[model samples]
Target: MADHGNDPVVVIGLGRFGSSLALELARRGTEVLAIDSRPKIVQSMAGRLTHVVTADSTDLEALRQLGVPDFYRAVVAIGTDLEASILTTSLLVELEVDDIWAKAVSREHGRILQRVGAHHVILPEHDMGERVAHLLNGRMFDYMEVDENYALVKTRPPREYIGIPLGESNLRRKYGVTVVCVKGQDEEFTYAGAETVLAYGDVIVIAGKIDQVERFAELP
Candidate 1:
């Protein structure tokens, strides 16, 4: 684990999501100070994290005394407890923490967190929806929108094109899309070149105008 000199991170809840994030951050060598009102919850994660405090984070003074304002950025992740989450976020802002990230259960909740000075509001459900949509859309292993007209796309090799050489297929000439890399079945990926061979289960990462990529994907 290597520290990146990030300000220590404080997580204000010990529920599934918050606990998981804290553990992951700790595993990555980031100093984490976790808090939960429930003694049992805090106790369970003790020793694994840098610090675990059993205190209500909505209390501004408690947060300040814990050195949250001076030593760490904080995340308010109290899902299902809307009031607590909002209060904690407001307190963190008042205390002037360097940065605050919050999780919201709905659009209205997100708006409120943003209005209260949360630097980032994440809607996990909404993000998961986009991931699911991409998985269901064949020819799209993963897709990131760069703009209205361009995107970076990852796709499995089209059935008819497997075993073909990059130069012979002339994918760029035919579809105006460039293959950025090819991930083969052996789990090795190489930047596209004339000598690269497409194999079964290979995934191709391509970047181009959105419509061109879509047109290319549609080819068998």
Candidate 2:
């Protein structure tokens, strides 16, 4: 959970995905307002979100009355109705919301949302499948895209490098990767200027070009 209490977030659907996102954001202490066309869904999620509203998200007038634009970010989570999802997203952009995230059922739907000014579009099922695949592979712990050419990655230490000293490894010269942080169970993480020795079970946070990082992972 990320702290977002100072950031107002609006979730414009109360379906399973929308409601789950709203609850997670609320748990993170964000000021979250959830809306749905279904009164039953709104009623069920009332206790979990900071605020809940029952209204058709496609209605621009209804959205305006709810001060949707005042939110720092908005999520269009209407899954089944493509028209309603597009309309809600468009209305949010027109109101000049700072950021907007849309859920797409397919590649075409994702592209349509992107053209309409959505800051991001998510294909939940596709993303989930990829995540599960990563977990099964067990080589990469997580991946963070830093830019077009670079990424920050978390991975287990290579077997041959498990007992090496940070200063002696010369990972930058050998693999072109820079260790950003080293985490050990017994001590706090060392960032950049770490003078610690690597040990088994320690997670390494490295930043570099994607190819170089992957090369490092391939080391025995």
Candidate 3:
């Protein structure tokens, strides 16, 4: 069909998640059409976005009048009103939008959104809570779950791993994790290799199963 990858995105709702997503997209120079049922919210975002409209997202005609169907991507970020969120997502699905992302407040909401044809359902609160929990211990500098049960984590090299070349360290064999990249205290991040020696104050990003990576990070 068409290459909708770079097309402008239509974002519905103006709550924390929707507003943040729209603003960030616009800041990155991406054209964004932000929609909300409240006039004040639309007014607040008038100059901040490419286009801001005060209209009911659940109304297909209203969306059509704003040219939402012409856009390739749509995000239904109405987290509070379940009926409105579902209706908006269903309309977008009927419009055959190439990519539909909807935010869900809970697991049941997410399931409904997926059943209604939202290509992607994001539980922002749940996800953020999980991520924050992982970073709370201070052992991990950063963490991203790549897939179910798999994650990539940035952490300081374990005490025993300090001053040892990766090949000789046998990290993957011993800890069941592979160091993907390393950044020394005084050097920029670089792709790690077998001969890469990790020293104190160095940060390394490793990839492996979530439990194994957690275990490795807790090594003494």
Candidate 4:
């Protein structure tokens, strides 16, 4: 058995989503056991991941042989095979995997995954669509969804917030958002405090509900 001690992650599937996710995790220096039922797909990902194997994840015996339950995290990235995806997730659940992150094609798919004990369900296309819309609209420099209703927003300080101390801005009170850090052009993010002054080119990272964050970004 490989020493997968550092919270190794198992990824079931070798489709676009699965392959990309496995590659990213592997690149980050995390131990990733990447699996797929297709031989060519497994062969293509051979050296790109920690370990790539060909096996039907829907088979409970196959998963057990691969030690899927031993890993702390598992991601179900099965492509368009919804039945296989759900079955794989179910097998993970039966084996009592600690954290299961499953990708779903739609909201209903996500709900079903959650119903089957997936710790987190992701609608990649829908989530990516929202992110793309936000980026194209130029409403914020960057946006990250924190949950269903909240987000972390990064943007240039509004004109009025410039040359003003963070304490006096009352961002949390007035805008229902909180500025956590600030960074000047070509500078790293620094912790923002009450006396921290905002500058013209300063980028502020704030967290709040999506609607409130949008309101804050609209500040002129």
Candidate 5:
């Protein structure tokens, strides 16, 4: 069995998403137990993570031997091999791991993972596609969906709102969004206030419902 710090995350599968997530977590100093059935993959990641194991994640005995059940959180990032992905997720749920995050290749796959008790199912490709589409449709420097219908957007201050104090800009009433923070050409981002002025070169983060944000981002 692997030795890990308190509440280490168990990551099963060493594919692209799995490896990237494990590496990032390790880089951030989070204890991670990374598992992959391929010996070569496990060997390649040996020194980078807290622990690396080569074992069949779909097999309950293998998981049990590796002490996966003791993990507080687990991520199944199997990119292909749907059966392995589903079986691993089911095994994790059966072990009663507190949180299970599974990756799905399709909507149907995501639904199935959810039905089988995966706490969270992420479709990375689909999410990336949607995010890219949003970027392509507007002048936004970046856009992040804060929830189903709300978002946080980074963009250059619109010309109409420049040089005016945020309080009198009618942004909330007219555009249905609020500037949460601003970054000037030479300064770090700071919380925006009623008296904050939006200069031409300033960048701002705005928050609002998705539709309102899309409209706001479309401004000239």
Candidate 6:
């Protein structure tokens, strides 16, 4: 297990994503260093994180003073500030930060971040819009992206699969997907297995490559 309690995570720009990330890490026993240019934002998070500093992350010297590069992980959660975001990410790379997570405002911004050495770039609006569209279309009950090509999805067991044991369905052999669990209509869950029977109203939790997972979701 990774010891999140020891290695601290540094979060920059205390906007919606940054503040939420810091608080959640702290809540789960991970030490967090939260930084922002805004005094109000830093002050708001005081005592909530291991340390909160009001400093300009884009300034190399300011980041050096905060020991930002010492952290194995750094998050650039700047809000709608493309220049600042890129500058901060560049500094992190220059300092050899291992994992850099950045938020991009647009496709171009994302490309730039990648070029500048951001290990992970997230476009929240674009990703969320696609997620909502999938759920609204009714084919998928819920969706989560594990990576560019992998995903974990929850959808009702295909109508024809209900009342049959998964062992006989040959789902894994046919679709290359695995059912991790089955959510019963009563809201309880059980570990899925070959012998476990699929029931009406059961939400199947399947994980695999996106294409396989979606194909399994459409199972009849």
TM-score of each: 0.77, 0.82, 0.95, 0.92, 0.94, 0.87
Most accurate candidate by TM-score: 3
- Evaluate model 5: give its lDDT: 0.92
Q: Write the per-residue lDDT of candidate 1 for residues 1-220, one digit (tens) a residue.
A: 5553566888989888899999998998888999999999888899778799999887877887888877557889889999999999999988888679999999899999999899999777776786577557666878776765888888876776677888888778878888889987778778988778888778899899977887777666
- In model 5, the clashing pairs are none
Q: Rate the local accuracy (lDDT) of all candidates.
A: 0.84, 0.82, 0.91, 0.89, 0.92, 0.86
Task: Give the runs in model 6 whose Cα sits over 4 Å from its true position.
Answer: 1-6, 172-177, 208-212, 215-220
lDDT of 2 by residue, 117-145 (tens): 99999889876685565445557778765
Candidates by TM-score, descending order: 3, 5, 4, 6, 2, 1
Instruction: State the lDDT of candidate 4 residue by residue for 3-112, as single tens digits.
Output: 54457799999888888888888778888999999999999999787589999998999999988878888999997999998999999999999889999999888899
Ranking by lDDT: 5, 3, 4, 6, 1, 2
lDDT by residue (tens digit), candidate 6, 39-117: 9878878967778999999899999888887899988999788899999999999999988999998889999999999
Please provide, for model 3 over 59-87, each residue's C-alpha lDDT reduced to its tens digit, 9 standing for 90 to 100. Answer: 88998889988988999999799999999
Cα misplacement distance, residue 139 of candidate 3 (Å): 0.6
Query: Which stretches of candidate 5 lie above 4 Å from their native place?
Result: 1-6
Best candidate according to lDDT: 5
Of candidates 5 and 1, the better by lDDT: 5
Compared with the true structure, model 4 gives a TM-score of 0.92
Any idea how many clashes model 4 has?
A: 0
Better of 1 and 4 by TM-score: 4
Q: Which ten residues in a row have the lowest lDDT in candidate 3?
A: 1-10
